[model samples]
Structures are given as C-alpha cells and as structure tokens.
Target: MENLPKSIQVIFDKNPKLSELITNPRLISNSPFIFALSQKLNYSAKGNEDEYFYRIVFKEGSSRELMTINSGELRGLPTTTCIEKGKISDVAGLERVELDNESNLMPVLLGISLYSSIQNSLSYISNLCVDIRNHQILEGQARFERISETIVDIFNSIPDLALDKSLRDAYLSRIVKNNDDCYELYVSQREQLRHSLKGNNPDYNSKYYYENELYLFKDKLLTHPVFSVFERLVAGRICEIILSGNYSKSNIQRHKDFISKAESDINDIMASRISDLDRRISYYKRDIEMDRNLTRDGIEYHNTQIEKIELGISSIKKQIFNLLGVKLSSFDLLSQLMSKDEIDVFLIGGNLIVNDMQLTSDEML
Candidate 1:
C-alpha cells in the first residue's frame, strides 16, 4: 500500500483483484473499478471530507505491535514509539549501542512514505491515460484527442489543491527550461510535415520520413523527465484539492484547448461511424436479396459479413456511451473526467507533535 499511489490504493482497498493488476503493467486499463473509484473521489469529495490517519508498526520477535503511549487516560492508546533493538541485518560495522540510538530513522521513513505515495499517484494516473490512448484497437489521432479532453475535464472538476504558486510554477517551469532542444525539434518536424502535406506530388518516402520523425518526437515527449514531473504535480494538486476543497481556476483551465479539440475529434468519429454503418447496412441488405438463391457457402459468407457489421455497430454504441453521455452538460459525462469526494486531513500527535489542522469544506476547496 505504501508503494501504490493513493488513487490506486483507493481502488485496491475496495477490490482485491485490482491489487494484483497494479504491478502487472499489461493489465492496467480504465477498468470498471478504476472508473468507479474515480467517480467516488470526484463526487464524494464534493460532499463529505475524507479522514486521514497515520499508522506505524514495529517488529517484535516473529510479529509486530502497534506503538503506544504510557500515561494519562489514553495511556494504552497507540502512539509513535521507539525501536529498542536492531536486526542481524543491521550488524554491518555498527556498534550495538549505535543501532538503538538511530534517532533520525523516524523522519526519514515518514518522508519516504509521504513523497512515495504522491509520486506513485501521479505515475498511476498518467500511465493509465497513456495506456488508454494507446489501446491496440485505436489507430489514429482521435484517441489522443479523446484522452486529452478527458484529462482536462478531470483536472477541472477537482478542487484546486495546488500548493504555493512558486512551487507549482517550479514544476511547470522545468518543462520549458529542460526541453528547449526537443521542443525546437518537434516544431521543426511538424513544419516539415505540414510543408510535405501541402505539396502537389509529395513522395511516399518523404511522407513516411516526416511521419516517423513525428512519432519519435512523441515518444521523446512521453519519456521526458518534465512529462513525469508535470504528472506528479497534477496528481498532487488533485489530491490536495479533494482533501482541502480549494479551487484553482488557472490550473483547471490549463488544458482547455486540448479538451475542445478532443471533443471535436470524437464527434467527427461518431459521425463517420454512423455514416459507414448506414451504408454497409444498405449494401448488405441489397446483396442478400440479389443473391437470394446462392450456394450455402456464399450465403454463409454474407451472413458473416452482416454479423461483423452488427458487431461494429455495437462497439460504436459502447464507445459513444463511454466517451459521451446521453446528453451534454450532464453529471454522468463527468465520469469521463474522474478519477473523488472528500475526507479530512490530519497529523496524529505523539512524539510527532504536528497537531491536526482544522479546515472548513470551503477552505478545503
């Protein structure tokens, strides 16, 4: 659970099967559980606050005990306690007395637990989005457009949970500063492709050359450090927003154009699919009538083709259902953007005296 992102943990805690799939890179899709978890975060965050608590376990013989306090009415209550002994694994050139006096271990472990959860959450969301766009069944730019729109919408719905502007900008600024060369190359390749496309007799070789270069550019974009940094930033922002309830209009609007483009592209795909289905339906019906007395094999082949057409229609319907809801501006469509409702934030007081910070629902947003 410590290794998994909070978003993934949310799903894992509810459905154990999903936990198995977490480390299995081959099976991560926008599965029903993922979608459901996403919805819960989006909608639940809007109403109630999420409760936060920290737990720590210490090793003792073959088992572990919850750390606890020793005084007052809550004397028996679990508390942050000290480690009394070290394992055989800690015997490397270390004095026995030194092992028990490792006072810095607690904060080091706490910091790891905190940042690891955050970084993992960002990786989970970004990887999921990329995987969805790269599904084998999709073969064009429409998938990118659709997923881009989905990302924008999801980010927009979450309350602005970004930290101070300087911190947020620091992550974002890295994108431009670190990737100037790649950005220039990408722009040059795009311009080259545009020029090639506008030519009267652009050779197949030239077209392929430009296309391949553009594909490489995209690969570079995905692998770039800045891309991962931005994803972590977005994930952290969303987590904070859901927990805090603060809304950042600027953050929400960052990818508005991308969303608009995706919506347009998806709409175009819907229209094209509908048109193709109508044409194929008419053609197949006429062919069946004209060959009314054909051999059994010929008739079977026609029937098979018709069945495939029917399947295509069914697939488009499902895609439409997933990508765009029954009506525009409906909450159901917001499911596409999801990935929460709320709880609370806390720092359990003990040896660690960080008091629980009180915040209202609005302040959280």
Candidate 2:
C-alpha cells in the first residue's frame, strides 16, 4: 500500500526474513490481510520463483488511510502505528516488479515480528526449564541435609549403660532357662571364645575366659524379660534426663522420638519442594506450547530433559533414605513429575548422572 508510511517500508526491508517473504507473492498472498491490501492498492508486481517484488502508487485524493492489523494470534506482526504519521506519504517501492503487498507490507512485517517474539519466548522457556529442573535436585538435597543430621544426632545420643555383676548373672540365668535357641547360641559362642583364648599356653592370670563369658552374658540378657523391662526403664529415665535439660542424660526413646519427628518434618519438606518444582514445570509446558513454532522434535527434547530431572529427583530421594534410613512409598520418584499433585522433578547441571541403582518404589522400612 503506497498510502502506508515510508517507515513501515523500512521495517520490511530491514528484516531479512520479512523481506524474503514479501518478495514471494505466492507465500504473502496466502495471508488474508495481505491479499485484501493488494486488492485495495494499485501496484505493479514482478518476481521469479526465487522472489517477488512490488511497487504501489496512491491515486491523487484517495480517501482511505492504510491501516495495520494487530492480532495476538499473529504475534510476529509489527503494528504500522509504530511508524511516524507525518511520513505516511513517503515513497516506497522495489525497482524490480513482482507480486508484492506495497501498502499491504504491514502484514508481512507483522508476521516477521511475531516470529521474532515467538523465538524470544521459546528461548526464555529453554533457559527457565534448566533452572526449574535443577531446583528439584537442590531442594531434595537440602531436605536430605536436615534429615541426615537429625538421624546422626539421634544415633549419637544413645547412652551407654553398665550392667551390675549380680543383675547380669540373674538375667543370664533366666534367658538360659527359657529361650533354648538363645541359650544354645550363647553357650556355643562362649565355648568358641574359650577355645580361642585357651589355646596352647593359656594365660591363667588374665580372667579372660570369665570376662569373655560375661560379654556373652550381655548378649543373652537381650532375651531376658527382666532385662528388657530394665532397658525400658533406662530409656524412660534417659528421656526424663534429656527433657530436664541435662546434657549428660541420654535415652534411646528420646533419640527415637527425635528421629520420628525429624522424619515427618523431612517428608513434609520434600513434598512441598517437589510440589514447587512440579508446578513450575507445568507452567513451562504451557508456555512452551504457546509458541507457534513448537515442533514434535522440540517437545520430545524437552520431555527428555524433564525425564532427566525426574531421575535426579529419584536419586536425591534415595540419598535421603540412605542417610536417614527412612523410605516413603509415596515418594515414588519414577512416577511422572508433571502429573497433577504428583512428583514434579527438576534438575540442574548438564553433567548430572544417576549413579545409584537403589532407586525403587518399594517401601524401605
């Protein structure tokens, strides 16, 4: 459209992609806006198979003003309004005549601009995908740190107790009378210890046999009801001591309680982090789909990227389990991370490898 602004003409020629398209009448005519604009203007067209070119001249006193279309569906198109109003009558044309839009060049410019925007949007998606995916691994590792520390603290806090000689002897006597298997194992073990200790020249001065037998007695005590009851009493005492703010007070029950609480907290933390990654991934997918240039290959590549993140999520969960001995069947990382309310896995780093083979859906109790 010759009635269109001269600056708009510059936009078409400056963009290589748009310039190439406008020179191809067969391609440009396919768009309805371009076809309509071409009919409205008086233009001479020329071009070969490789390119089409056109020039348009407005008749003196033409009443209509050329307008540019702005539609979201055609995100690439630049608006003709962007050009200065005073420059609309400036001359624009190609020396070579071909099927061209002339004033209708606005559509071609708009299409190219849309394409550029799409590329930029796609690029954003690609970059964001990398971070969102990596975040999955990072978040899990953070939770792992907390849970593992709690576990180590619990294990280290267990108190060591000394058994009295008389109490030990009494517990052993009951175990020997009641549990035949335990009694047999203890006796067998003591005999083996004696056989080794008394070899050739036995050091008689060392009460090594009785000492070893005493050690065996402790093992036997584990099967005695009295000793088990005593162990519970010790645990309760330790818990009380710890709650009283005594540093030296250590209890197995306290440790167990702490571990249980830590485990629950860790589970909640992991669920929230995984959910965060999943939600972002869903958004990424939606934005990616919005790009008109999206290809099957592009989608497949991104899906593979997502799979890598999912595998990473699984690996991190396994690490947490290994560190804390807490495995959750609900944390089945193999399930699709993108599924609503399901695991949304994300990973960072291109060189990440899932080295552990222990990732399975089985509940590790």
Candidate 3:
C-alpha cells in the first residue's frame, strides 16, 4: 500500500481489519483484484499521466444488502460504477459487520467474492477446453453455458479498469486469447467427429446431422455479450483506428487485397460445388435410365434426388450471380470512398451474403 492513493489510505486507516486481509500473503498471492491493482499502481508510479481511483459504497435497508464499486479517473470527475448495488449475499458465508454500519468490511468482502468468482471462471474454462479436446461435445457445451454466465458475473463485479491498456493486457487479454484458442479447438474437434462418423456410416444424410449442433455451440459462445466485450477489449482499438482512417496507405491496400482474395476464394468454392452438383444430377439421371426394370418407388426416389440436387445448384447460382467480376470490382472501389458507418453497413451486408452462400452449401450437403 506504499504508493496507494491517499483516499484509499484513509479508507484503510478506518478499516484496519480489511487492510490486514488484503495484505495477507495467502490472499495476495491468489487475488486477481490485487494483481490488477498492483499493475495499475506500478504503471502510475512510472509517471503515466492518467490517474485512477476506486470507491466502494454500501447501501442498507434493502431485502438484500447491496455494495457498489465505482472506479475511474481521479481528475475530471468522471466515474463508472461497475457494480451497482450488487447483492452482498451473493458471496457465500460472509458475515456482516455491525461496526460503522458494516462499511468497514464491505471492500474486503467484495474483493474476496470477486477473486473467488474469477478463479472459478478461469478453472471452469480450462476444464471446458479439456472436454473439447477429448471430443465430449455435450459435456463441453454444458460447461460452456455455465462458464459463460460465470464470466459475465465476474466481469460485472470488476471495475472498468479492464479498459485500461495496462490492466487489459495483464489480465483480460489472457481470457480473450483463451476464448480464441477454444473456438479453434472446437472447430478441429467438429471436423474430426464429422470424418469419424462419415467413415463409419455410409448414409450421407446423417453424416452431417451434428454439423448444426457444432455450429450453434460456436455461435452461442462467440455471440455472448460478455464474450463480445472481451473481443473488443483485445482488438477494438485497432479496429477503431482503421475505421477512423488513421491507418497508413499500406494498411488500406492490405485490407483491399484481403477482401479481393476472400471474394475470389468464395467464387472458386461455389464453382466447384456447382460442378459437383451437376455431376451428381447427371449420375442420378443415368441411374434412373439404366435400371429399366426398376420399381416405381426406386424411380421416384431417384427423381426426387435429382430435383434436390438441381434446386441446390439453382440456389448457388443465384448467390454467385452478380458477385463475380464487375460487382466485386465496384464494391472494392466504393469501399474506399465509404464513410465509417457506410463501411460498417457494407461489411454487415457482406457477412449476410457469405451467410447466404453458407446456407446454400449446407443445403447441398
């Protein structure tokens, strides 16, 4: 507490027991809160211009006693209350102090509660990663749901100190990176499962039955609000700089090149799929003709298969209709002149286009 703010020092003086708990070697070693605070203090001591402070408030007379933690700049007077009247009882087995209207112990209690939560979340995510690696799909999905909720709760308890570059890089960045790795692991497991099932079963219809389940699992985790926040914490600044036109000419050219390559890859994949579908349709037609003594039911099944294949081809053709040459070139040129919001709209529209192509591909499969 040597470089701690005077205001925090005053609070410590008023609450000696809380100070003792914070300085305890065991708690300090295991505490995320202490780790983050130490990082912030070290950075401030290095003569960084930004000053930070934390304020804790306890409210009485409610059905559930509430505690709030507000933190932000010591100057300019702007503060964000990360935990607003959160239920104190949410922390297990914590007894309230009657001294000084229970304010003396609230800060320590809050710290312990948040530390436990973060530890549990990190551990749970680690186990989920293991489950994913072992191909325990259902078990992994269940653990993910629990971890997702736990992470949101942990984030809500902590201050916006995560917004600080130093604090984010020290702590939250690990969680973000872990999430990215988990997603990749999930995709790899899904592919492995798909291949395993395909080899063991000849029914193509049931071969990909698990595909939607895998896709939904990935979608649910990535689209979680807390997960999105974590991603933004990791990459939002760079994205903002690029969108704000603060990037160099080379960066812009790189982006254009990336988009062009993506478009070309998509077109090539679509062309290949269309050719495969055409060959399948031709095979089914020949099967129906070559089996001259075939029953009416067999003929009907072959015709139905041909109709589905033709429909898939039609769907793909419609998607790739205006996307090949001129339209893509115009899109590349127009993106350069577009405003930030317009660029966002264009990117969103592009995702929708890609999603449509994905749907077409899934239907064909």
For each candidate, the alpha-carbon lDDT, in order, equals 0.36, 0.33, 0.38
Model 2 Cα lDDT, one tens digit per residue, 1-365:
24224544455456667544443111111233233333334324433244343434345454234435556686654332322353454332223333333453433333222222222212222232223322222223343233223222321222110001232234334332323332233334334333433343322244353334333323331122222112222222222222222222133344445444534543444444444445545644775778778788877865765565466556656654533342211122112111213211111111111111222244222
lDDT of 3 by residue, 43-152 (tens): 55686625434333324432333333345544444223222345234321232212111233233333233332223323332232333333324435554444344344
Model 2 — which ten-residue stretch has the worst lDDT? 346-355
Off by more than 4 A, model 1: 1-123, 126-164, 172-260, 266-278, 290-298, 316-342, 349-365
| Model 1, span 203-295: residue lDDT tens | 324425333433433443223232322332333333333323223444334333323343343445345435545565566668778966777
Question: What's model 2's lDDT at 243?
Answer: 25
Give candidate 3's error at residue 6 in angstroms.
38
TM-score of each: 0.32, 0.23, 0.32
Highest-lDDT candidate:
3
How many residue pairs of model 2 clash at the backbone? 23
Counting clashing residue pairs in each candidate, in order, gives 27, 23, 0
Candidate 3 local Cα displacement, residue 207, angstroms: 17
